[model samples]
Target: MTTSVPPADRRVPEAVHRRRWAILGVLMLSLLIVVLDNSILNVAIKTISTPAPTGLGATQSELEWAINAYTLVFAGLLFTAGLLGDRLGRKKVLLAGLAVFGIGSALAAESGSPVQLIVFRAVMGLGAAFVMPATLAVLMNVFERDEQPKAIGIWAGGVGLAIAIGPITGGILLDHFWWGSVFLINVPIVLLALVLMFWLVPDSRDPNPGRVDAVGVVLSVIGLVLLVYGIIKGGQLADFTDVKVLATIAAGLVVLAGFVVFEKRSDHPSIDVTYFKNKVFSAAIAAIALVFFALMGVTFFSVFYTQSVRGYSPLQTGLLMLPLAAAQIIFAPRARLVVDRFGNRATCTAGLLIIAAMLAAFAVLDTDTPIWLLEVIFFLMGTGMAHIMTPTSVVIMQALPREKAGSASALSNTFRQVGGALGIAVLGSVLSTAYRSGIEDKLSSVPAGLRHTAGESIEATLGVAAKLGPQGKALVGPANDAFLHAMHVTALCGAGVALVGAVVVAVFLPGRTPDAQEGKEEADLVPVAEH
Candidate 1:
């Protein structure tokens, strides 16, 4: 019902324009909670794996499901959520999302079983699906095109802030309170965000949102669910070549292909699939996905390496991750300057290579590797990520017209979530297979009946060792060694993935030019209808 730039260049609403900064702050607050929840959960993984009263005693696979359930659902519904935000109203969708997120947080806090936790996590993901895209959409509508990059830089910085805070906060909660407190803490933050949003945030929506692509939505979700199930199952069983796994994975690909075909053929597609024809746009999306694939996988296993293999407590592990977050906070906002000088291709490729180097560095780390060296790797990794996320994001968002802001945001995030989820599943599988093979012979002293269980994961092996007392202590060293080997294999795999991403952006993203820079500067001089 309102436009910041009208046909005659009418004066922008003073209320909307004046409150832009405040609205940004509120949007960042919302973003922080969604990001914080996951980062906090990372530190709690080891705790949640412990038995009974103190923890949930969930298996490594179960812990992965808990995390992936959120990601899968978030990825699955994000496009739909974005469409709804564009159609219904960003402000309304945001409020609804925050409320659902709060309720889901409460439910997750009270979950009595791993199954319960996974389900509630999916619910949280559903809410998060709405929250993530809507926040970006509202920001796009409120900020002037010329200032959008700066605003987005700050927005990306908010993620870094959450990464810095989530772990330490979770650590403090775990040290003093229950594991659930990590999630329970979201309640008050959600409440505060809701109140601020109601007062400061303005509503905006596309005046003519087309009809929903119901069939396409269903196909995407089903395909994703099947693919992820297949991957997770293969990991859980340590047998990817199994008939069931192959069939499920193939079916998922087929369904996804069908969805794409239907969308291309449909009159009103959910996404303008043709945007991918732009080499720069497609390349940018690939960059986002590949970077997250590597980052999330590394993050998933780092906690275990620090806490389980190196004997750091949850708090210590949380503190250890600080260098990573600090580097992001320091570098993310300033990355645009680097891009201005280097261009997107050069900047992103350099960042990915740095990340790859850091990941490969993990291959040499051992139980006694100096802690400071680990910190350096974390810092470098973060520095790489800070650079990669910003410019790639700008490319993806700018590639689409302003009206499709919600869809653009959704597409970027969807690939990110999907990439991250697949990374965890695939890399986790590699870790499992490698560890099991390394430690299988060592388990010969154990009874045949329990050998499979002991070989399942480091956590499981340790649990069995503890039950055997002195005998168990003997298994501890071997378990650590096995995990180290697995980490080496997994880290190398991640490094390879990052290297692939580097090649991708280097090949496809455009180099710097005077015209491109001038266009960016003059973006706000006039508004044009894209279609």
Candidate 2:
């Protein structure tokens, strides 16, 4: 009540500040678990769906639900979670997230039915919503302005590492244990992260937090869920013109538009409507979205190409895919240097161009393509992605006010998740359509029943081929050729998308002219309050 402390004296101790790096480790570990969870389940899906002592006899739709449930819930709740973190406390929300995730993992491993597993996965996604945004928000709060790009580089690299390791890890676990072991692995990692985070991470919250935007939350959740549901359904049915699909998408878009208008008019908006006016911020978001779109599309085909076409075991396929992740790990940390020397606009454009070229290269792949050549393509693709992801993320975060870090992080990640989902839906539909047409044409001489069964998927085609004895041998050549044709078409489409993103990055992303950018940074680097 008596004395006023100096501003410098009010800042947290240097020792406490120095612990930020350690805190980042915990944050990365949390991020790794979530990222790994997304892909690890892919390897375990067949095992979980089979009928046996170790399996649940899940229907095809139920298996799809197991994956979609997690994605839908995660995407739906990200903004709300971010808002809660900023208003309550990031560390508090993060701890709660970790607890939920660990518990969900434990329960999921013990689940006896597909429905139970899907429900638990949704719970895990809710935890992920809290954890993902908090990680980035905390990183921005703790790191100095100059150091942020490097920190983000590491964080992005960790995601790349998770992508590479998840399938391999899942395959190993499934080989030696029950399919549930893949889910169980998350528990120990979550426990370790919880202990480290509690000890090292500092708590931070908005000093003048506003009231929760309940209406905005409801609108966002409903709109996103409906939109994703439509997309997933369209992909599954390969029918965008279906009445249900069209109606749901239309309704979701209308609701989302209403949400934007409401936010702009609200006094205590969940997200600052004006932030989108920053060209760099908007462009960075677009860049990240498109990068993921192209990456996911290619990845969907690559997995099929390796396992279904090349006849690699799950472990071998995972090992073969390592070049992509290894390149990102090696190059991502150095991306900041490139951005510093060049600029975000230039670096991102270059990266996108590289990605476009690689995707185009992938279009020409056939059954006869050399494994080494595929490895090189994957490596270059990862290198391009590393260049794009880290710099764009840094640019997006830097453009926002420090107090809005959580919301900004959530916005960034939400766009990424949406883009990935759309990629899989749209490109997957393209692949499926082309495969169906080509296989149907090629199987003109095949029995109608066998042809219909084989037309469903490459896996089913091979399975049917095996069952027909010597006559099944005739199906192999046509099926392989048809699948490769579909892959080529999908890759070309992805390349076109990447090229468009490159043009957008080049034209819209602000350049880092030294005087203007440095001045802006200096003006914006006001010290935020520390807990």
Candidate 3:
């Protein structure tokens, strides 16, 4: 593989660098809005549940749908949207996505029913589909080869910042306004982003773009949606014999299998199967998926442990997550440097080991576990996240040609989202089953009245404890212990997954730096930004 350098004049041109940074700013702002929107709504769930017009009254799964619906649609459509960016102009599609996202946010804010909010959230996901890949495609086009790693690192950190601020922003909003205010928050930021894009960013597209494959889009969406639905519904699917869940999952696999066959045969495919032929791309995708798999597991149980088990308020729960965010902020830039010095394989393997160790640390938690120790674990998790998120994106985008950057980058994002969704579904199922069974075993010898109430919910049981005075509260202790034990067990399950992922990376990722191979393949393909 041969590596060619841009002419010194082209590499160092002041005007070109300024314009590239300007476009990066626009893409960063757009992504900030998208990432913030994802997590901001999380903290508002309680507010929406209590006093909002679209309150989730008595349906736990519907409550889950409020969050998972957007994720499901976002994950489902990403592949199509990425391919569309290749066929259509990235800038045109991205601007359109911004407008759609703004509209969806407004619709969600004004929604009067849970169903309407869920629908609008899905619409936002649709817009997100276009926005995400377009951002990277624009960056890949704009930045020179040598500059991309640092630029992508900064870009990844910006995403981390949005994640950090989301819950805090949601908390502050909830303190002052209705739950709808969270959705309203996106409108103004998006308008500002639109204005900046018009003034600063130039339009760019792939010159020899491929044809749009409508069939691939359909099969991909159907398959992913059904797969996510089955996993999410697993908790509520009565006795594992629920026909709807089984059928949807079965159909999803069939559709995806068909999609593979279709893509392989099609003259113009949306997802070019040949991209996976690159070892760097394949390994990077695996690493990215596993990172979120671990992260989503942490997110799911942390809230439950902090709130339901320890009786922390929503604000307190948000505060507890702060260390995780803070660690990312501190380590992300450093992670990029590490990757540069040690190469992807060494750096990524080390990082995954850190993550595995951190996940395992959570397995030892007990009612008497020290608060300081918990904070330390959260901090380590953030550091591990820095390693996982920062280098993986850079690796994946760098591995592909500029023309295929959007579709390649989309896979990175898609896997993480799908992994998170699956992690929550599967880990949630494990927690629910373990908690229920533990609660049942503990209540065997308790009075009949208490036994009946134990089957209700942890919240209901706690409420009952409050009413029955001190003695009643003592009876609630074992239930809390059982719940915490279940959480610890779930965390160990995550550690196991991370360990497996770490081993996979060590096995498959090339022992050498990937730049020489990448430089050869992309030699003829100019960046989209350069046009």
Model 1 TM-score?
A: 0.92
User: For candidate 1, which ten residues in a row score worst on lDDT?
Assistant: 522-531
lDDT of each: 0.83, 0.76, 0.71
lDDT of 2 at 422: 66
TM-score comparison, 1 vs 3, better candidate:
1
Number of the candidate with higher lDDT, 1 or 2: 1
What tens-digit string does per-residue lDDT give for candidate 3 at 402-482?
545545655666778877766766676666556666666665545678665553335435555655677566748777877
**Which digits, one per residue and each the tens of the lDDT, describe model 1 over residues 450-471?**
7988887888888888878887
The runs of at least 3 residues in candidate 3 whose Cα sits more than 4 Å from the true structure, single-residue gaps closed, are 1-23, 46-55, 58-60, 83-88, 110-113, 140-151, 241-244, 277-280, 340-343, 393-404, 440-479, 512-531
Per-residue lDDT, model 1, residue 389, is 81
Candidate 1 stretches greater than 4 Å from native: 1-12, 15-19, 140-150, 397-406, 515-531
Name the candidate, 1 or 3, with the larger lDDT value: 1
Clashes of each: 0, 0, 2
lDDT of 3: 0.71
Minimum summed lDDT over a 10-residue window in model 3 is located at: 1-10
